[model samples]
Target chain A: MASNLRSPLARVRGLGSAKDGTGHWWAQRLTALALIPLTLWFVAGVLGHVGADYAEVRAWIGHPVTAGLFLLLIGATFYHAALGVQVVIEDYVHNEWAKLASLLTVKAALLILGLAAALAVLSILFD
Target chain B: MSAQDEAASDPKARRPLSPHLQVYRPQLTSALSIFHRITGIALAVGTLLLVWWLVAAAAGPEAYAAASGFIGSWLGLFLLLGWSAALFYHLANGIRHLVWDAGYGFELPTVYASGWAVVIVTGALTLLAWIVGLVAW
Candidate 1:
């Protein structure tokens, strides 16, 4: 069974499939599923703390359970966002070079932002 | 477009996409699908608000004040409302997609019903969230 049915011309030029099968699709769905509950929890938590003092909200996030959820939520949120925005870029940005540059910029920015947020959570938890 | 690829078929004027906008009529099904992506991307951008609030809180009381000040401002509240609406739309539509992946709801009536259901649920949840957030304190 020839799994790679791509034309030799296409193969020679090497502008074909992304080759990773359903990894992107699966990861997107998994992250979406994880977000279902995480997002609800977050919305409720934020609403609960509305109009509360800084110390009150800080203590809430500093709690072990809340911090743990924040970590998970941060990781999943950024990963999911990067993957998604990448798809949108690929879809509308027809120019090859521009698409590549945008995707790179977006992924890098999200990575940095995600890490910063995670670190903030950890700092809050341990401080 | 590569020379070889463009020669075979002009990428800009790509052919045989049967349901393209030129011939396709917009319907609930297509509109809902569009909103799914729209809301999804909006939420992706909206994550910035979350990150900023978290980092500011971790910084100190003064920083938290800055963050909360912005979030409490009219513009921030407006954006928050949009973000929450987008979140709910994406969440509800996402669940519909999950059910679709599970191999049901492909029937036309079912699909239309689910699409409407997603919209209704999004509206209800967003309203609930805003009331609970803005007034329940």
Candidate 2:
């Protein structure tokens, strides 16, 4: 009962092609591209607000444009960081279960923290 | 056990392992590539500080003061300085990666040159940021 399905080359390659190739790679690069300008803007904005009081800092965050951009920065920075860290874990973590646990932890932390940061910005903007 | 199973379970089996860092002479290009990953992880962990500051600011003046106090302290300043440098290095090297993705800068000389540029740019940006921060404070 020989079923001729996959070609010899495909059979030889085995499960290597099962993974979502290039998606992670492309996502990492795309997020990096988005961060370039966002990071520069963030650095400049922080520098401009140096030595300011809490009220002044809150006021700065409360601005419509600044809050919007800050939200964008939070999202991109966390997402990019998660993707980058996932690769490091996958490469270095030898134990399969540990690797899975770590990957899950990193992603969960990023999601929770990203949401919290965004909410903080929103609260300031509305207050 | 079957021969196939025995072969699969054999400890002495020869399989391809990734080239270890010890095998290669450390070059600027290789060092920068490794540093890129290290800084990326640092930046990831450093995002917690950013989140804490934002939450504190949103919470109230007292919370904000507490957070700012820690950030203004010597140890906090040191960590922040390191974080800022990591951020800049990761950002610069990330741009170099984007260029590589665009199908350029693969030439050996160009790669090495870009690696050094990332290092120099990271240093300059970090120094400039600290200078501005200190002067403004």
> By DockQ, who's the top model here?
2
Instruction: Provide C-alpha RMSD values for all models, in order.
Output: 4.0, 3.6
Candidate 1 accuracy as TM-score: 0.89
Docking class of 2: high
Predicted model with the maximum TM-score: 1
* Local distance difference test scores for all models: 0.89, 0.90
Model 1: number of backbone collisions: 0
Task: Evaluate every candidate with DockQ and list the scores.
Answer: 0.70, 0.85
| Candidate 1 C-alpha lDDT tens digits along A1-127 | 1897787656545543576556788899899899999999998899899999999998999999999999999999999999889889988897889999999999999999999899999999999
List the candidate 2 regions with Cα displacement exceeding 4 Å. Answer: A1-18, B1-16
lDDT for predicted candidate 2 compared with the true structure = 0.90
- For residues B1-137, what per-residue lDDT tens digits would candidate 2 score against the true structure? 88977875676875666556567688888788898999998888899899999999999989999999999999889999999999999999999999998999999999988988999999999999999999999
